[model samples]
Target: MLAIVLSAPVVLSDLYARRVPNAWLAATLLTAVAATLLQRLLGATPVVWPSLPGLVTGLVTMLPFYAIRWMGAGDVKFLATLGFLLGVRALLPIWIIGCLMTGVHAVCMLLFRLPRIAYAPGVSTVRQHLHASPLWQRSLHARQGRVGLPHAAYLGIAAIVTVLTPDLMHWEGA
Candidate 1:
């Protein structure tokens, strides 16, 4: 519930503006930390504490991508927030799945643009009629080959996937 509340606005921002808002990230981080502390105060064994190491690992792991200009600062921060939400134990798997999903998304974007690349660069195709409107339609149509994934959006999807397929990610205790 908290995850949905915190992430929805960030997702919307990423989809619409190609950016994540700092305010959203800060709120999410604070909420996560507060939740961890509150759980500890209630003697709930502090599941969030064990996950704390994920914050470091997640940030460190993603730093290279951001350094290379493959990812934005906001995206990196968003991923670290996900690390905190998922915890240390679930961090690696979640990150891996996110990466996989990103790859799939990239491939899809490429595939989507292939027809445009091959034939009418400026013309829309009958295929567009067959396919439902995709999330990145505005950016993809406007920019052509220069299109890039609003990668932060994929992280949100990865988080949802983690929740849905917890068994696959070995999220038993986490």
Candidate 2:
């Protein structure tokens, strides 16, 4: 889907630096907007649609986490922007799926005692480099504990899976 294609970088950035760059989000917004307009011009439902209620829903759903300082502002904004693009129908399922995945990740961390790579105590995120990241991902890093989960990564994964498999939350009918 177009949303998946556009959201990839934001997800990678979140995984890399525990951050979602505004540039990438802005790019996504612009692209979606352009695509929506074009789709309308063609007299069809926009594939890259936007939803005001979804935008609000995303912010409302995630704001509590941000207020607790458990989630970064980037994560919240990323979700909100994605909500705007993917619409309300998809956002809730994405959120539920992301939370479940994060729970699994936490359990794995506890079970395996995942090692955390330490860094200088006062290193800035802007100056940090992804030295340990793979050759293809020599692009991002930050001070992160192994126990902490980057919600954006999980949410991005959820969004992709939800879009690809829309019946994920409709199993009740089965």
Residue pairs with colliding backbones in model 2 are none
Once fitted onto the true fold, the runs of candidate 2 whose alpha carbons sit more than 4 angstroms away are: 41-48, 113-147, 169-174
Q: Alpha-carbon error at 26 in model 2, in Å?
A: 1.3
TM-score of 2: 0.72
lDDT of each: 0.69, 0.74
- Candidate 1 Cα errors over 4 Å, as ranges: 42-44, 112-123, 126-147, 171-174
lDDT per residue, candidate 2, 12-109, as tens digits?
76666677778877888787778888888999975645877888999998999999988888879888887988787788788888889888977865
Best model per lDDT = 2
lDDT of 2: 0.74
Candidate 1: 10-residue stretch with minimal lDDT:
139-148
Every model's TM-score? 0.71, 0.72
Total clashing pairs for each candidate: 1, 0
